[model samples]
Target: MTHVAIIGGGPGGYEAALVAAQLGAQVTLVDSDGIGGSAVLTDCVPSKTLIATAEVMADLEVADELGITVHDAEGDVAKRTTVDLGKVNRRVLSLARAQSHDIAERLDRDGIRRVAGRGRLDGTRSVVATLDDGSEERIEADTVLVATGAAPRTLPTAQPDGERILTWEQVYDLEERPEHLIVVGSGVTGAEFAGAYNALGLEVTLVSSRDRVLPGEDPDAAEVLEEVFKRRGMTVLGKSRMASVTRDGDRVTVALEDGREVVGSHCLLALGSVPNTADMGLEEAGVTLGKGGFIEVDRVSRTSVQGVYAAGDCTGVFMLASVAAMQGRIAMWHALGDAVSPLDLSIVSSNVFTAPEIATVGCSQKAVDEGEIEVEQVMLPLATNARAKMQGVQEGFVKMFCRPGTGIVVGGVVVAPRASELIHALSIAVAEKLTVDDLALTFTVYPSMSGSVAEAARRLHHVR
Candidate 1:
């Protein structure tokens, strides 16, 4: 049996371990930060769980619109609801820990050896793990999968004190919500947190270095979100680069490069991420390191060295946990002599867990604009959908892109509540190369937000 060694315990590492073990390979997973890595332990799971609570808060805000009144202890109608930060944080951490425990249990059931340590490549086919007890163990493997994930990037001029200023992972430790929260960076992380805090009834100021929030996403979707944010009284500082963040007593201030400063009760830096690839002996083992210190891997997850692979954030590919899991599985299939398909990023679906979430799959608008791919497009407003109207959702839309000649769905985007779930059918269409007509003919439940997806496809079908 092939012996597989996976370093790091994130989605990429754990997922690969399971596939390797199931394929009759002896698998050993070495991790220092528990079995779920940052995803389950701190980043993805914790953040999303917190967002779930924030989502409920947002729903309650519209209860009156739905003719639902919340009564207080005195039998008077309550004008607003309040959040208990301590309780919310406890629930978030609890859910994250529960998920990590479950993942560990699954790995144990699969008979995959779990080593508690920091692992590094000793050579092309060897892993040396330094345990917490100051002992070391060496494992011989036929294949090595490196899935060390990433951490939040910090700037020298604006450092996190872990008190008034915090990283995305550190936010869960807050026992009190800020009166005015200033979020630096306008990427997915920044946007999601700003939106969540705003929904939770906290005053928020979003500092964006770019002209718009979520510059990497669809412009139309970003525009809609920005409009909603501004409408809801979020102070969006567009085209404003943060020079530094300093805390004076209880007040934290963010200084912009343009000589303007914004003060808040707390600050969050969501600039980007830095891969955890230092001192791993990767280059010594003939695994090439690319720009920003990310591991260089091919479509099948192989590094430059034979029998060595890298996946997930360390590879600098799409940072989504789903993509990381897929890369890990692909690496195992290839290493174990099983049939394997290279990673196709275009079909990977991703969602930004903000209010009126933005989800997308396949080719993006930038590609079309750059003449990289020609396609027909149709966008339908969700406001026209019966269910959206019933739910009092006035924002969001569904947009579809298809080949002009063949009508094959190439890409699609959804902007609505639970857009993440709504993008699955479109993801399947893009993955299977299904035509717009095929999507249009598929049965959809009436009075549903998903109906907008079919409607958009139907319009695209007619355009071709």
Candidate 2:
């Protein structure tokens, strides 16, 4: 059997290990962080879980409007809804650890040998893993996969002290809610945390270097989220670049380049992340390093060296867990001689778990505006949807793109509550190259949020 040695235990690493094992290859998984990687143990899972709790709190704020209210023993309607942050955080961490353990069990069942240590490429065909006990283990392999994930990016001017000033990972350790939260960055991570805290009834300030929040996402969706943030009494500082973040006692202060200052009880830095690829012997083993020290790999996850592959955040290709997993599987299939298709990012669906989550798949407006592709587009407001009206969701819309002539659906964007779930059908249509008529004719439950998707698709027919 072909021996495969994989490094890093994140989605990319663990997923690849499972694939190699199932392919009848002797797989050795070298992991340092737990089995599910940062995506499970720290990043994706934990943040989303926290957001889920925050969403419940947000919904409670509108409970009275829906004729739902808590009655006290004195027969008075109770207006207080408070979250025990300590309890919520404990639950988040518990769920993450449980998932990591489940992945470990699955790997063991697949008969993959796991080394709980830090691993690096010794060469194209071998790996040297340093165990936790200061012992080194060398493993020979027919193929090697590097899936070392990434760490939260920190700037010299803005350092996380893990207390009053914190990183996203450190927030869950807090036992009490902050009186005021100042989130720096205004990207997906920043917007998400800021929105969640605001929904939880805390004073939130979002610092954005750009004119609007979510500068990298769909502009329309960003506008909706920004408006909601403002409507909920959250302060959004636009065009303000963070100069320095300093903490003196319990107070955290952010100094902006424009000579402005913002103070809060706590600060969360969401400045993005850096790949954990340094001092890993990748370049020494002839692996090419790209901008920001990420491993340079192609669609098939092949590095510069033969028999060597890289996937996930270390590859700097999307830095999303789902994409990382797909890259890992593609790498294994190609390495093990299984019929393999290269990674197609266009059809890859993504979601930002802010209130009224933003989810999109396939083509984008930037592509259309730049004249890269010719396609007709349609957008429908969610407010017009019967379910959205009944649910009292006033913000968000469904937008779609399709070829004008062929009428084949190419892309879609959904900005609504659970847009993540609503985008799955659009993802399938884009992946299968289905026509707009396919979605328009697809049966959807009446008075549902998903009906907006069909309505959007049907409008695309008229646009063509």
Candidate 3:
């Protein structure tokens, strides 16, 4: 039987082990962190759980319009809605731990050897695992997969003290709600946290170095979210670059490059991530490293070495959990000589979990603006949708792009409640290369947000 050595137990590593084992390979997974890695233990799962709690609070804000109201012991209407963050944090951590344990059980059932140690490539075909006791285990395999993942990026000037100043991963340890939160980034992570906390009844201030929040996302979507943030009483400081973060007692202060300062009860540094690839003997084994120490891999997840492959955040390809899993699966299929297709990032759908979420797949508005891809487009505001109005959702829209002549769907963007769920149909359209006519003819539940998706596609059909 072929032996597969996998490093790190994130989605990329564990998912690969399952596929390799099912394909009749002996798999030894060297995962120093618990099963599911940061995606489950701290980053994705935990943050999304917290965001779910925030969504509930946001819904209550529109309760009056929905003919709903909360009552106190005396049967009087309650004016303020508050969240028990202590309870919410506990629940978030519990769910994360449960998911990690579930992944562990699955891997055990597959008969994959799990090691609790740090692993690094010793050469082209060997992995060296350093256990907690300082002992080492050398794993020899026909193929090796590097999926060590990444850590929250921090700087010397804006270090997280894990208390008043914290990284996104450290926020779960908090037992109480903060008086004010200063999120020092306006990207996905920063915007999510700011929106979540603001919805949860905390004063929030989002600091952005750029002209607007979510500079990486669609401009119209970003504009809607920023407007919602301001309407919800959250302070958004755009064009303000962060210089440093310092905590003085219970209060934290954020210093901007312009010498201005903002004080808050706590600070969150969403400065992005750095791939965990150093000291891993990757280069020593002839594997190439890209900018920021990320592993350099091809479409099939192959490293420079013949038998070595890499995936996940370590590769810095999209930095998304779903993409990581796809990369790992592709790696195993290719390594095992099975029928394999290269990773197609264009068809992959991604979402920002902020209230009034932003989801996108395939082509981007930037590509069209820069004349990278030519297409006909249609955008329909959710406010005009019957379901959106019924649900008191006034923000967000559905936009679709298609070939001018063939009318084939190339991309789409949905910015609305549960946009993540709504983007899947469009993802299929893009993947299958379905034309606007195909989507327009499809049935979408009437008086639903999905109707707007189909309606937009219908409008695009007229381009031909």
User: What lDDT does model 1 reach?
Assistant: 0.93
Give all candidates' CA lDDT scores: 0.93, 0.92, 0.93
Model 2 TM-score? 0.97
**lDDT of each residue in 310-347, candidate 1, tens digit only:** 98999999999998999999999999988999999989
lDDT of 2 by residue, 39-145 (tens): 99999999999999988876665565688875455633324566788999999999999999999999999999999999988877889999999999999999999
Off by over 4 Å in 3: 71-80
Model 2 regions lying over 4 Å from their true place:
70-79, 462-464
Q: Could you tell me the TM-score of candidate 3?
A: 0.97
